[model samples]
Target: MSRRDIVTAIPTSFHADGSLDIEGSRAIFRYVAQSGNEGAFVLGTTGEFPAIDEDEFRALVAAALEDLGGRMRVIVHVGRSSAFEAVRRVEIARELGAREFAALTPYYLASAEGAVESYFEAVSEAVGDGSLFVYVYPKRSGIEVSPALLARLAKLPNVIGAKISEMSLDDIAAYRSVVDDDFVLYTGADRDLVAAGEVGAQGVVSGVSSVLPKPFRALAAAADSGDSETIASAQAAVDDVVRIIGGDMPRMKAALRSMGVADGRSRMALVEPDDEALAEIDRVIAAYR
Candidate 1:
């Protein structure tokens, strides 16, 4: 992958009962691959990494690798609160043939800049030659990656980039101005992919891609072809549709289910979106189409 390909995070498909639906997950993976996206990230935020067990994670990666069969680049997000666990996941991802890896700053209990550096170092040491990108999403993990910290970490032999999940357009531009060319700056927010791209985001790390791969891939292709109009159209379509679902994750799952892709029931602890919510989402998508 030329680092220009849009990289989408794959969500683990779950059955109605909330069990890992490996087959469903594979189907979704195939869907994304066929959509012409450059690559997909397995076991990341949208994959419900925290709720999934170690065995499930292994199985999910193995299944995706088998299905992808080198058709698309596979980037694994091996971040966990525990550095050891993150390293272990990195090893598993490597064993499954994943060449790209991303690790978020550990969540909760803010780590001193040194501790954050140490965590990436431990993961880097474990995953040897695989390309690595720092995953920075402070809202979920109270830790942020400073430009200075990112610059220091980018010097690590195998660390190639930082996945900027929270940086606004100006912030992204500021970081881009300071970072070296070899260091990638992948945008984390799906909704801001176009803005990110305009400011030189290498690619997108999107949760919305789990369901709407076609649109996301379209935006990516536009960026590659230098076609701003097409990018705007695709991004607008997604933003308009996602409006009805808004911040309700359950509704997002329900919306996908309504389209015939089962993403397992929104895991326990989340209230499933009711029929009314689904109708609103349907209406939003229908209006745009």
Candidate 2:
């Protein structure tokens, strides 16, 4: 398997007042490293990279490396509006000992496939390393990266794989059918873990992993081991909690609170899940457990 295997998405750690809690963030990295899972992902959607500044990003990388103690591979997301800034971050991140990089297409406005390709190429050249993976989340970024475009970009010596969040199952299968099997294929949607795995997804970067790492790990293992029943049970467990939390970061945040991990406060502009949402999430988690 490639080094970029199943990676758990990082969670946005916040204080009661909804400020970045570096200590809490470090604790999360440590927890995932020791959770019997492969490793943890940083600066992905759940990490709220869009809201964090460069300093916070550096701090996150530094703290995760310290807490992880080199036990797991660190895949840092470097997507940003300014290509220069993204490239600079990747260079510094490598110096910090991050082995892999994942970056999404630039946001704010959609661009042509050629522009997206050029943007990623610039990042790869700036880092002077071809060991990076592209993050594809058209649903959130307003950029639809066609499989043809991905196939074209994959030609880059450093671009290794693509992490897709939205697409029909048939589209995913079709993309997989066309791409080199050795190229990594990951799903950003956590609830589709089983189906994704079954359809030849090499790994997943799931928001659920921040709070329910064990369950996600179990589900992946079940799928990998061909244990359909186990996969079903685990998927049901994930679906249960996701339904209460509203099935995204909000739900994942509430799950952390239910498990007494994160403080249940998202950064400003993104507050804690409402009381009803939290109560419903708790009820569902309790039933599942």
Candidate 3:
């Protein structure tokens, strides 16, 4: 596997009453920077972007850039259900000096290939000189960003890369085949980091890394060095951590709280982990620590 960058898809911080916790979010960004990961992908799926309003979104973006902009790269996710709204987000981040941005395909209503292409065309234009990453999460967006579509989008000068989610290694390889060698690809699958690298993905935008970064960092190192023993160990650790968290917003926040990072509440309606599950999550964190 080639050297792979690990960018954490950090969660948003919210108080129990479902309000944005700007300070807590700043602390979370600070923690990601201190953890030695390559960068932070903020206001992403893990951050619960859909639930956050415009004001809350702006505050989160400002807080993340303020905290991590100088220390590391910060990819702001400006994906929204409408092209106009997505462009507005791009403008907001650009004003804050954000250079890299990712936007998912328009969600909720089904979008045809033409509409999707137009949407990205508008967003790429808005990004102008800044870098734009096409975020393809078909499961949530209900839109498939086919390799063919991506090939066309790649023609846009600033449409530099993509962060692919819920797709197979073969699917990613297909994506790689259609684009130029310099076109970057980052897998959203935390467990397949090494395999994705093998298939030409340059990195992973990992939600799991937001909480347990050590194992992911260790895995990246092991892959780079071809250390089979360490790779196996790190991969096992990552799988276990993902299983414990299970992509639950509440559970991830709970794990963050266990690490003394931030509050364990979500604006989205989600069930808090039971005591037994929470105990297991703590054990998982401690083992990695």
Candidate 4:
């Protein structure tokens, strides 16, 4: 069986007034590592990267590397609307000894044809010899990365792999068909780890795994061993986690708070769960325990 990686898309902790919570962030890093995840995909969608300012971004990168640098692989997301800014983040992470980086296609603007390739080219150049993964999330990036585009980017020496988020297994299979055998693929859809693996994806960059990782780890294990019963059971647990979080950062933070991992505050305009929702979240967490 092939190796399977479960890298958690962790959240950036913030105080009530929206200050960076360094210790809280470190605690999350420790929690994920202790839970047996292979890596941490820091400062991605789940980390609220778009809302984070320059200094906050640096602090998060430093904190993550400090906490988990040697213990596990830390794939820092340095994606920005500006390739220059993304390059700057990549330089910062490199200065701090980060070896793995991921960059999203430039967003919030209508780029001409080939702009996405150019953006990745700039970031990959900045990365030098370090590994870089193309982050393809069309729903948020306002751009679609076709498999052909990925094929072109894959030619870049440092462009080693990609994280395909909010996409279908068919999409993954399409991507798998384009890239070479060594080029890695990871799905952002948390519930489809086993299926994605079956389709040639080596891993997952799962947001749901940040708050609840055991099921994800179990699912990866089952995938590795090709254990049908365990895969079904672990997938069910992951589904329950997805249902509880409902793909909302506020609820994810709420679950983390209940788990005593991090506080439930966000810089984004996300609404926290109210009475009924909070009660359900708590009940579900209790049942999981």
- What ranking of all candidate models by TM-score puts the best one first? 3, 4, 2, 1
lDDT of 2: 0.74
Name the lDDT value of residue 46 in candidate 3.
Answer: 92
In every candidate, how many clashes are there? 2, 2, 0, 0
Residue 242 miss distance in model 1 (angstroms): 3.4
Candidate 2 per-residue lDDT over residues 1-289, each given as its tens digit:
2222457787768777767888778767776777655666788887888888878888889888787747777788888866887887888777777768888888878688888888898887765653788888877888888778888878787878778887766667866876897888887777776677657677777766666566666666666666678768877877765555533676676676677765546774665567787787777667654
Task: Tell me, by lDDT, which candidate is best.
Answer: 3
**Tens-digit lDDT track of model 1 for 110-206:** 6899999999889989878888888888888999877788888888768888888756888778777777975788887777666776676777777
TM-score of each model, paired residue for residue: 0.89, 0.89, 0.97, 0.96
- What's the best-to-worst order under lDDT? 3, 4, 1, 2
Worst lDDT run of 10 residues, candidate 1, spans 240-249
Q: Tell me the whole-model lDDT of each prediction, alpha carbons only.
A: 0.75, 0.74, 0.90, 0.86
Between candidates 1 and 3, which one is better according to lDDT?
Answer: 3
Candidate maximizing TM-score: 3
Candidate 1 stretches greater than 4 Å from native: 1-4, 220-232, 245-249, 284-289
247: Cα error in model 2, Å: 4.9
